[model samples]
Target chain A: MIYEEVLSGHQQELRRGTVVMAALATLETPGYGYGLLAVLEKSGLSVDANTLYPLLRRLEKQGLLDAEWDTTESRPRKMYKTSQSGRSLLDSLTAEWNYLATSLNALRSEEPNTPLKELP
Target chain B: MSSLSSRYVTAVSRSVPESQREDVEAEVAAAIADLREARLDAGTPPEDVERAVLLELGDPMRLAADYSNKPLHLIGPDYFPTYIRLLKILAATVLPVVAFAVMLGKLLSGGDAGEIASGGIIAGLGVAMHMFFWVTLIFALIERNPGSKEAKPKWDPTTLPDTPPGGVRLGDTIAAILVALVAVAYLPWQHFNSPFTDAQGQSMPTLNTELWPFWIPLLMLGLLATAVLEFIRYRAGGWSWRFVAINAILELLVAVPVVWLAATDSLFEPRFIGRLVTEGWLDASLHLNVTIIIITIGVVIWNLIDPLRKVRRDTAMRAKRVGSLG
Candidate 1:
């Protein structure tokens, strides 16, 4: 019932789904899980290894992500990328999201609250 | 424990698949290290920091659940309500029956009626328990919407088993039934009809109960049918509502003989509850009987619900995939 707790939990879950798409989008150029997390954070997404690792797996399972081991370093790191199918799906989801957002905005603007009048 | 940590990580890693473990462990290890560093920055005591980090990591059971996308309960969201309702209904039927069996055992042993509450209270509690379970189940189901990824963790099927191993094979089930027959049928019949008498010349209760011969074969046949069905499942891809249908048929078959015996005053004498009070051995026998019936029914219903629900889900998923392609 704590408002901050509820807000943060809700926000965390909301971001988790998008993390897959984000990872794939970033991995259009090959990056590992930690690398992807860093990219996400740089892009203002703020993902951690716990969250990113599972998202990577889910995306890979869906055949939207592909991985290969990079053992050249002292420790091997699995690098991932956006698969062909993944790119196509990402494009579709992105377009659909934008369209949905536009429609939602139109619907909200028509509401009788007169907040539009108060706005410059 | 710090030295053992890598082993623990490796064990957990192996518990998943070989392909995913190393990277997953590295990430997990990094997160642990990060938490440790953060604790150090906060100037937390060294001893407390390790414990805090461990606690913050959460239980490995939950971590595995997170990784595997395992729901808290065996049943999925869609069928959870119906499953809970069925459990409630079964629990309702089972409680008073068990209570009655217990009460009968007590009564037959010359215990006071006051010691046993009337059947109404038991029945009511059973119904209430049933409703409570279903209500919670319905709420949980309603809460599960794919649109809302709120508590839904992203699931990767590649790291998980294609199918859960939580199924009873027909052969093993058959073997269990055979064991039950030996214990319930052969041993008791041998004891009851054995030519030898005890020192007091009073024979053990043995298989003198009229329900003995009929119940044994009836139960065994039920189990045998299940074994055969599981065999078919192992050999083939599809085994639909066979488990449930078979169980229901067995229950009906057993019920008829049970009702007849009870009505004719041959069984349920002084009630199974009265027997519990009268003969401690009888109490134990009834306990075993009730346990077997309850377990069989539970397993059958669970088996029935999970597969059919999965079939529906897979069908829906396939449709979605096709739709997406189109």
Candidate 2:
């Protein structure tokens, strides 16, 4: 029998890189942390809020995201958006993801032990 | 402010740096409030929702560590090898030497068995503590440095025992910093409390007073930089061309101005020279100045050449070993 937890753990690992790309893409519309969390969940990336919040802060530290405390509400919320560098990063990450998918698919369909052709 | 959510938030905020505490606290509190409201709106029981929210957020201390980019450990694994190696070397070399020296000194002073034994043991313990404190402090700082994290290469078991990962001795680094610090302190001390006195009996500075406002402090600043560079070179571990370049730059920075000043007869004070000449301890034939220039240039050249040789030797040794293995 397949272990559900094991499968989910692997699934979580697979989703990890995608989650960064997702958050960077979502925050381009300019939203606060909790709002970004909801958007990620809606898109089928159920990132733990604990993980997402810290990650957002880390990205901001790396200059991949810009953050400002929005004081419009009674409680101030820190809003984040992808920076110019982040936009470029998101695009590159997206291209790389697609390239990986294509490579994986090619391997799957490949007949056993046919020598791998060097990339052009 | 005393609510469960605030409590949860405060736990994390308190762990981060104080400057970030207010901001992190406010942000975390707002996040927790948002989570609780969403959970409550879904018709979950109030108690369960708040408890679940806190549980999902996980350990506040860990979160704070992540937020502040502080490692949970005192010394990270990257520096652990060098740290262990340093302690082992100290235990083998310094501790026994210091203990024996103290015991000898105590015996010469006609101390009994009890006094000698106690003095030796105390001296060993003091030296041990001093070494441990400094070595651990340096490794901790290196671990905390952001560049250390990025520089962490993937560990390959096959690369085991490949030339000592850390090139320089920990003793050398500590010695550098200590010597520089003592020299820096000695400057100020000698300025005020010099054994050399004027005709009116005021203690006069040994170094030329005219060099005071600019050159002396510049020399001290250069010493401080040398100390910092020593620490950096030690932390960086492996010998390289880069370190050799930095070494040369630093040597010139300290030595050039010094040798130039000495050569121009501008380094030592007139009073000190007068005292030496009047006492027939020296001639006016530029003997001392020439010696100073010779020693300074010799040291600078050795300092510059030695590291370059080590880096080349290490690289060749590694290549030869890899070839032999193949």
Candidate 3:
């Protein structure tokens, strides 16, 4: 329960920043909305449309994404790719995220009795 | 096939802007359709596919709304406080330019103080018009998009008040009308002679002409038209292509004329620009002012036209697609 509470709070927020990176990384090859969602789910980061659609728009607005409509099929799909700016941002964020992960892991390991202490 | 999948897709397509919606809808529908097809291909009964797809798609309105990229706030996402704030700033900045332009015009035209004041206010109003239209547009788009965080700092959904946002109220309207009436009352006469004298002591040329060459009136008219259009859209709770077409037409009608007049020096006095160049700022500021005005006009045209072009192109494309589909 404590682990769940911690995950739903601080850990989730920290992971939230990764959504952009995850989205950008997945979208580098040009994926549509549902396509990206499937990729996210496969990668263990579930994204709802309510979050992804707006995030995509925001990223595009910020010049981090380039999108185009593919209408060759029976239905059309808007495909998005990472822009040059997004690539750069993603690179930086990835490095920072890795560093944070390492640092957090080190801290967790340093506290040898941390998990034991949390027991009721 | 169950009607649910078709209904769901149709609903999703509606909330989204037409230009990109087709592809979006296709992707979504195809995803569902593929599943249905697979079930049939796998020897599963087709009757159950509709229920499954409908259930998976969830509420048509919410799914479409989410897909539409409409903002989360009740007030809407397309509207932004920062945009409004910028508009106010632009309005403030444009007023002085208008005042200076009108004052110089009045002095050149040999108008009374009242005429100068009225012209200045009109100029301010013109700037206000541009501020209103562009700002409203930017905010409206922001409001429409549920995903925009541009207004995140200022807009709060959980605590959003039940009443509509307060803007220019009845008192403000009355005040504006009174001001306009004053401007009309203080109109410059046809025969008021110029007070400007060149450094060489020769009398400056008269400023009297058929009209004032300021772009303010056109900007005002565009704003007024847009306001009326928005009011209609507001009451109706939706927008139509016809409304957009009318808005675009109004913008062109007002902007093109005012810009033409300002560029040609036909509206104010024929001699206004000439005197301002020859007499004001020893002519350098006149050149600079003209450049600034031209640049401003260019920017306004670009900003205003860009959205209209997108809207028109998207709407046309949608129509073509729908036609083809039929």
RMSD of each: 20.5, 22.8, 25.3
Clashing pairs in 2: none
Task: Provide the lDDT at B67 for model 2.
Answer: 79
Error of 1 at B16 (Å): 2.9
Ranking by lDDT: 2, 3, 1
Once superposed on the true structure, which residue ranges of model 3 sit more than 4 Å away at CA? A1-14, A32-35, A48-63, A71-79, A106-120, B17-27, B34-45, B73-326
Q: Which stretches of candidate 1 lie over 4 Å from their true place?
A: A111-120, B1-4, B14-58, B73-76, B101-111, B114-326
Q: What is the TM-score of each candidate against the true structure?
A: 0.45, 0.50, 0.36
How far off is residue B180 in model 3, in Å? 64
State residue B212's C-alpha deviation in candidate 2, in Å.
Answer: 87
Instruction: Encode model 3's per-residue lDDT on B1-326: one tens digit a residue.
Output: 25677677777777777885775566567657655654577677777766765676666667665555555454443345556557667766776777798889987999998998888888777777777877777676666555665536554576543763222235534553554444333333322434554456545433324444444444455556655665654443333467666766765665566556555645444344455666544664345447645765785577466545545554555566568999
Q: What tens digits encode model 2's per-residue C-alpha lDDT throughout B1-326? A: 44777778878998999987887787788788888778899788986888888888889998888778789998978778768877998999999999999999999999999999999999999999999999999888888888887776465677456565436678877997898888777767777778987666767777778887888888888778878888887776646677777767767887888898998899877787777787687774277788889999998888787787788765565566668999
lDDT of 1 by residue, A1-120 (tens): 699999999999777667766877889999876667657878999875555666676777789988777778756567788999999999988887789889889868786666667787
Per-prediction tally of clashes: 13, 0, 24
Native-referenced DockQ of model 2:
0.52
Say which prediction, candidate 1 or candidate 3, comes out ahead on TM-score: 1
Q: What is the per-residue lDDT of model 2 for residues A9-97, given as tens digits with 9 covering 90 to 100?
A: 99888988988899999998999988888888888888989888888888998999999988898877898999999999999999999
lDDT score for candidate 1 against the true structure: 0.61
